[model samples]
Target chain A: MAVRDPAMTDVARLAGVSHQTVSRVLNGHPNVREQTRLRVQAAIAELGYRPNRAARALVTGRSQVIGVVAQNTTLYGPASLLAALEQTAAESGFAVSVGSVRDLDHRSISAVVERHLAHRVAGIVVIAPVESAGEALERLPKDVPLVTVDGDPHRPMPLVTVDQAAGARAATQHLLDAGHRTVWHVSGPSDWFDSAGRIEGWREALTSAGAEIPPLVPADWSAAAGYRCGQMLARMPDVTAVFTANDHLALGVLRALHEHGRRVPDDISVVGFDDVPEAAYFIPPLTTVRPDFGAVARASLEMLLTQIESVSGGALRETIAPTLVARRSVAPPPRR
Target chain B: MAVRDPAMTDVARLAGVSHQTVSRVLNGHPNVREQTRLRVQAAIAELGYRPNRAARALVTGRSQVIGVVAQNTTLYGPASLLAALEQTAAESGFAVSVGSVRDLDHRSISAVVERHLAHRVAGIVVIAPVESAGEALERLPKDVPLVTVDGDPHRPMPLVTVDQAAGARAATQHLLDAGHRTVWHVSGPSDWFDSAGRIEGWREALTSAGAEIPPLVPADWSAAAGYRCGQMLARMPDVTAVFTANDHLALGVLRALHEHGRRVPDDISVVGFDDVPEAAYFIPPLTTVRPDFGAVARASLEMLLTQIESVSGGALRETIAPTLVARRSVAPPPRR
Candidate 1:
């Protein structure tokens, strides 16, 4: 007859202990007698037995896990925000598990949620730039409590978000007050709230000042895209001032302007958002609006834990504001 | 009589179910009847019951979790590397927990590890940067298996790291081939292996060329530091070329050069390591060495999992090679 695999029972028998004793040793129970534990461990090691994590989790009925669903795209905001969030969560005795979905389509987003479900997470936080996550949220089972960061406030779920509009307004007014005729805009993808909000603020500033609002050029939040837009704007003699969606884009704009023989602040003035860590090192030391990501991340963790506690015990909502960090990328419109 | 806090038992009694049945319902076990599950959930919600994660972990003897000890500093490599590692761990049906240390000191690093132990992690991945975490590793219980990433290869434990020295060599050689007499150096923190490896590669290239090797100016992987180094170098008439340790520093060098009235490629040429997404946006479009972090991350994960399986199944050593990406920043040294 085929030999039966030496299971926990056999290991327990070999170690002269009960099966429970062998299990205690396997699961890292400190209460086990060291000598007896060693014997059981030796037996198990000799038998090549591996305890199943899933089975253990099922019997316990608590997963000891928290899930974070985030975009794979390397934007400074999301990346930094997550780094801060993970650190905070770990301190609070929670594991910060993560899933990535580039697209906010139902399947992709749902896959993230379902994967978390399979792990049986205590809670889930979705971090994405797209509004489609809202639609995807509706598909989640009513039981799981969720907290979203950098998503739409209009969704029927608890959310923690930075005040994108206020940040944009601060950036735009900084340029407008510097006496530019109308600030040109290089925006991120239309679907992103940050891009749309910045556009609105730029338009609002121009409209309020009675300056003609120029059309915004759409670009992904990359330096290359900004350089392309900067190349186009450098050709326009009247384009003496500009505002970019982010620092990377601004870097591109600066590069393109130099190539076109337009000196920054002499031929044209510029402003950028997201005063990224490297922004101050830009050739002219970028004057950009810095978002208060730390505040947002802290608020997100608080909001998520609150909702998790409330939902598991009982859902509740919270919002946060973004602050502007004034720096050197802005100046008065250059004289013709 | 004084009222006892209604624990899981009270909820189970109120919902007319066994304590185990209540646990199944709370954990979203599919076997529980929907009606009974809803009743138990309602009782739980009404009573404001919250399960202690620690208590549950104690009973189950398995956490279904993994601890990730990473750097708290916001560097591109660590930030992106952490994100990639998290995604991989989550996909493998394990929760990725995180902790960060500002330094490699035993107290700071060990504290993070002990905290993870308190939560009962299945395994750990130490993203140790310096010689410091090795001390912390000694303090940890030997039974718990660990995998180190971007750590010292000579350590007794398994290590997974990217080839920083090779990437630096490629950057220096690229400059030499571009017709530069020799490349000067700007490096990251003295403690980090990345900084040291790049410095070695640069020195090796100069030594092999039989050229005079200059002393290394230390920077903390920031643009401001790079700019300061750049300012000093720009004034040196013989310093016609430079190789910065990272892209952020290269940006600062560009700024310092621009301020010093030196035209890139015309007055001086430069190359940077870590082709950050914004590298091409630099004034002259920085030429940089890009480390294959994705390959490193993938190999690290595979090595880590392999080691875990081997230890559990009793099986060996593994290593991976690094590659480089060449970009625009290198140019011929200007005529004296």
Candidate 2:
């Protein structure tokens, strides 16, 4: 007579243990007794039973894992976002598999996405802000609920982003209201959505106030780049009030202004974005905007999880607002 | 004779494709024509073939995936190290499965290690410097090769660490050589081995130079912490030179001193460690020690990979030297 294959129950019975004990051994639980584990393993070997991960996944039709795709940038924003997401994901009942793309481009992100697919991730959180990641969204598989964190608001699908434009507008308006004729901008890379948003907001504030709009200086989100912009602005006596895309660039501007004998707020009033932890300690202290990344992380997990469990596809698009922390950096433009 | 069970070659034969083509289809190779892929998939479904990952791992006894365990700290040092490690691992043709613990505790690390084991990682790089992580090393599974990046030198297994003591000594010496009576230190958390190394080095430099060793002021490696220490030191008339655990703290000290009406170098010379990218731009610039995290990453990867490939376990214990960058922060104490 043909015999049935050995099941988990059969292995448990042979080991003289409960099914839960056998399962705990298989799961690599540390609480299991060593002697008890050895017995269960021996029983499994004798019964020729295998409880591999892929086999279990195939039977259950769920991996119960989330893939977090992030840019491999050392910028505090992305790093803090990743750390916060990881912390929350661990606390919640889910496992996170992280994949960092060399750049936030379609080809690089897609390649990472394909690798994640092989692991059968239940959902993916793509931290998109680069222009290329916006285009990469089209190539993504729509079968599962995918969310983008810190991406352009215009991008499709469930998205959670910070209000970059509002932040820029507040910064610019602060300078203009303080008696500056106009505010010059030191922006991030043009291809970045954050850069574009900040530039647009700066333009909007200047136009609304009927102030002169000076040519915007471009930077690559580095203190060195900001220093270069500062050197040029320091030479131009008319460039009194300046707004930078982020705090790092602001730092460089402060250094250059100091070297060129242009005192901040006295000679060139300056403002920055992203109140990183060190912003409060910057030379004249930095007046900047702070993005609540922890809130973004919590909101993102809740939204992605809601999509993950529901049979009905819900489109969730939300933006987190940033607040201005005024320090010693900004001052009214000197009398012209 | 009874019909033989379906095999991979049988599926290839039915699809009228080469064995390599079937492999390409199962592995989701993009180079294959769509029609060819469809034909191969149809044959596989007809034969009821399953190409599961865990099953493949059991057969091959090698997963070719490296697991990277890191502390979930937003401090730039750890963040930069993790980023560098990920970048190098990706370029080295290895899949990096990252697992971050809630804290650098043995229980948490063990739990994460269990999850990684399920993925059948070939090796592990533990970026551990906390005391609990050093204790947890003994609990790791002995079958796999494990190495710690920036961990304690006394801990077991292969280790790649920066010479924190040397960095601290140079920072202290730099302050002492500038004609200061003694250098007071603002140290990191005591539980951290990194902090311990730095403290020991500071004490060594003081004892060796016939200088008095003042009380060790402990901190959590934050700029705010440094600011608090600086506020106290700035009030003290004898506190002329101060050495901080990191550049972030140095910034806070600079700010506090400025608030207390004490000018840097002329009033109080300051030095920091981990010459972060923004160090050169701090108010007066910063003279600090620079740790080459890229070199540490490369060395750790080479050691881990060698252990992973070789049956012999070579005990590799090494330390990367840190160089001091002289900047505007340190100057000879003014004549009293």
Report the C-alpha lDDT of model 1 over B1-336, residue by residue, as the tens digit.
223335689899999999999889877788988899889999988975655444455465445467788885367877778777766776675556767776778898887786666556767888897888877887777756677877766677767776777777887887788788788999989888778888988999888887788888899888889989999998998887898988889889988998999888777888887778888778887888777666666666666666555555322234444445555656677766
lDDT per residue for candidate 2 within B17-129, as digits (tens), equals: 99789988887788999999999999998975544443445455545567778886477888888777776776775656677776889898887776666556678889888
Could you give candidate 1's per-residue lDDT for residues A1-336 as a string of tens digits?
324335678888989999999888876888998889888878887875655434444465535467888886356877777777777776676666667676777788887787676566778888866778778888777666577877776666677777666677777777778888778989988888778777887787778888898888899889999999999999998988888988889989988998898888777888888888888888677788877777777777777776666544313455555566666666777765
The TM-score values for the models, in the order shown, are: 0.81, 0.84
Residue A9 C-alpha lDDT in model 2: 90
Candidate 1: residue A258 lDDT (0-100):
83
What's the TM-score of chain A alone for every prediction? 0.80, 0.84
lDDT of 2 by residue, A1-336 (tens): 224445679999999999889989987999999999999999998976644444455454445467778885467888888888877886774566677787788889987776566556668899888878978887766776688887777766788888788898999999998889999999999888888888998999999999999998999888889988988988998888999999989999998998899988788888999888988888788899898888898888888888878766554888789898898888887776
Candidate 2 segments exceeding 4 Å error: A1-11, A14-55, A58-62, A333-336, B1-55, B58-64, B177-181
| Pairs clashing within candidate 2 | none
Each candidate's clash count: 3, 0
Residue B89 Cα positional deviation in candidate 1, in Å, after optimal superposition:
3.4
